[model samples]
Target: MTGNHWGYGKDDGPTIWHKNFPVAEGTRQSPIDIDPHQASHDPNLGPIVLNYDHCTSINISNNGHSVVVEFDDSDDRSVIQGGPLDNPYRLKQFHFHWGGKGCHGSEHTVEGQSYASELHLVHWNAVKYKSFGEAASSPDGLAVLGIFLDTGDDHRWLHMITDALYMVKFKSSVTDFKRFNPKCLLPSSLHYWTYPGSLTTPPLHESVTWIVLKEPITVSEKQLGKFRMLLFTGEEEDQRMRMENNFRPPQPLKGRKVRSSN
Candidate 1:
């Protein structure tokens, strides 16, 4: 979870992922260009929680375009207890979104505006886990927690894993990370915008209850620069072939209503 060894470097890079995973056909992805004028009403949302706490198996990887700190060190899954998810779910993965500079990478638009990056805390309802592969094909199988990011502080929260950057890369590895509580990164206020949507990645399975936190967290420009130093592996050849932009575009609010727990 902490070491920053993973990324699109020279060796284990995106080109291979493209070959193996190629974008799933008809998958709803992220990073779409939105026009602010398209803002819509946010309805009333249900409950949410962060379940299965105590321990986690963390992973740091270069997901093509940006570096992500994925939660769940192993099969031991941690808990996040509640928000707008309606039911209890298991914390699975946490990843991030970034841009060449600032001004992009978030899935939802704010009154039509986008931000530099976004962090997603992905979760899955335990009831559906016995067969998540199958359940994921539907709308209620997954739950994703979103947090917006902007420029400012150095984001000491990231220090939670910053020192680990020296560990795994090109050849992804896992480690025993300490008390890195995801909740610590959350703003004191829990105000959020909720909606029914699909995973913002391939397989774009429409199995999600998305909770977008209202307050955005800040990370310094220097901290962000560290991401660029990541290498899928070693060398220019491998670096040129890393995974980037694994995000799915937003689906039509398709007459679908968005609920908020403000």
Candidate 2:
């Protein structure tokens, strides 16, 4: 994490990430376009299970990349299992990638069609590794559940998050946010496409096992506008750059099998 300052700008964008983190060019890169018809349905893959009833949500912050809501992963109170996972992955945090007014911003797409935004619920293999940092570099270390967000009617619970956006409108800003359950963000269906992939961000470790939902949630344009109000630069910086289009484009599938659980 030293000597590497990567951002979604012209000078420090994705194309040159490999200069700092060689793994950015790894074979299992993520944010790939999923073709439902091409994905192989796996009867062996059971329904994914999520037990987040008593999840301990910590605080929310703007980390220059996206607005992140971190959770307490000291225990397995919030965990996702089944599907392609042999063991449960402990929920750590959730973040969003979005675009500026009326632009597509989702990291992953389907049939080459992009969405307005994308949400990534990141988790780590706590059972196998002692800590998230240790697991983050391993091949089977992380599991990120990605959900798409489209512009439409205002989402029921999304306002709960958007309303808090002002508290962290600048990079490195944080505020207390507790007792929030992410289950409210999920779509009705649990069907997903699972594959081996890497983190979309730098130190682009090829350690993530991605599970992308087939269905997308709806949010209003006004609601998404709140996110754009935030800035990539800190409050002290002279220039204020609007935070949008913070998503990496689709990478090469590289012969990876995308297994669908339907």
**Best-performing candidate as measured by lDDT:** 2
Model 1 lDDT vs. the true structure? 0.57
Q: Among these predicted structures, which one has the highest TM-score?
A: 2
Per-candidate TM-score against the hidden true structure: 0.73, 0.97
* Candidate no. 2 TM-score: 0.97
lDDT of 2 by residue, 163-207 (tens): 999999888899999989999999999999999999999888899
lDDT by residue (tens digit), candidate 1, 38-157: 434444343455544564645565544445565652343575445555556677667776554444656666766766667888776666555455556666777778888777888878
* Native-referenced Cα lDDT, model 2: 0.92
Total clashes, candidate 2?
0
Q: Note the Cα lDDT for every prediction shown.
A: 0.57, 0.92
Q: Which portions of model 2 show Cα errors greater than 4 Å?
A: 1-3, 236-240
